[model samples]
Target: MRLLLVEDDTRLAEFLAQGLAEAGFVVDTVAEAGDAEAALDTVPYDLLILDLGLPDGDGMDLLARLRARGEMLPILVLTARGALADRVSGLNRGADDYVLKPCATEELVARAKALLRRPGGALGAVLILGNLRFDTLAMECAMENRPLDLSRRELAVLETLLRRAGRVVPKRVLEEKVYGFDDSVASNSIEVHISRLRRKLEAEGATVRVHTLRGIGYMLSEEK
Candidate 1:
């Protein structure tokens, strides 16, 4: 999944972005509301983590503006404001959830995952296909109840394919999901990960298969 983090605090932004990336998300961070709004206009992010205070404007206005424009992407507010009224105000402005600052990255990641599981979101806590079972939160995968060992990148690739099970996922979309914007990637990197994933699944006797559509993308489906 891709995430946009709108935070002015450099250290906190780095910490959260690193944590979210480790948890299989591609995160882009912007320090001000203008940059954040620009980023939002271009990227189709799965979630947004916003800080309440910005150098140029209040986060409330940004939240309200997005909601008013019918932007339904899940928004999570991460701020130091813990007052009852502040929380209520955030919810009223269309923030899906609120998290106080000085929080553990683990807790923040967990909360973000929960919001992604809401109705209309692309994620499920656990994704299943044939004999394959993947727990996105735990980052675990199993085939027929036996653990399927995979590298983090491989796991991410599999997760994307599983989520869109029968539909073709474009190669460009896969690249965006598996890598952050700043990361330099080789042209064939996605293919390498897909190749490794296919071998692992075949070796494990999984009933699901990943089919490649040359010049287009890939799809995951159960063998007939």
Candidate 2:
């Protein structure tokens, strides 16, 4: 999943970014509300981890503005204020959930994943395609009843394709999904991963296939 983390605390932001990255999320962080707004203008993040205390403006105002603009993206508020009033206000301002500062890493990750499981977010809790079953929480895939071994990039490629199964997913979208904005990608990097994923699934006897449309993109579809 791709996410924009808006936090002013450098240490906390770094910690959460690392943890989220390890948990298979592409995260771009901004310390100010202006930068956050600009980032949103470009990248379509799956969720937002926003801090109420910003260097420029109150995060609450930004949250309210986003909601007012009909942005229904899942937003998890990270704040030092643990008061009931703060929590209530955050939710009232369209925040999906709240985690107090100094909260457990596991709890934060769990909350984010829970929000992503909501409708219109990322993948569901579990994804089932043909005889292949994937557990989003576990980040594991199974073919029939056997485990399907795959590298991280391969899994990312497959995940992107599965989300748009039976439809074309452009190469740029796939690249952005699999790689962070700062990460340098080689020419045909996504194609290489897709090729590897295709071989692995075929060798595992998966009932689905990834097809490339000439001069366009790729699609995931059931095998004929």
* Model 1 lowest lDDT segment of ten: 175-184
lDDT to native, each model: 0.91, 0.88
As a whole number from 0 to 100, the lDDT of residue 153 in candidate 1 is: 83
TM per candidate comes to 0.94, 0.95
lDDT of 1 by residue, 9-86 (tens): 999899989998888788999988888889889878899999989999999999999999999999999999999999
Task: Choose the strongest candidate by TM-score.
Answer: 2
Off by over 4 Å in 2: none
Model 1 residue runs over 4 Å out of place are none
Per-residue C-alpha lDDT of model 2 across residues 3-54, encoded as one tens digit per residue: 9999998898889988888887788888999999998888888899999999
Best by lDDT: 1
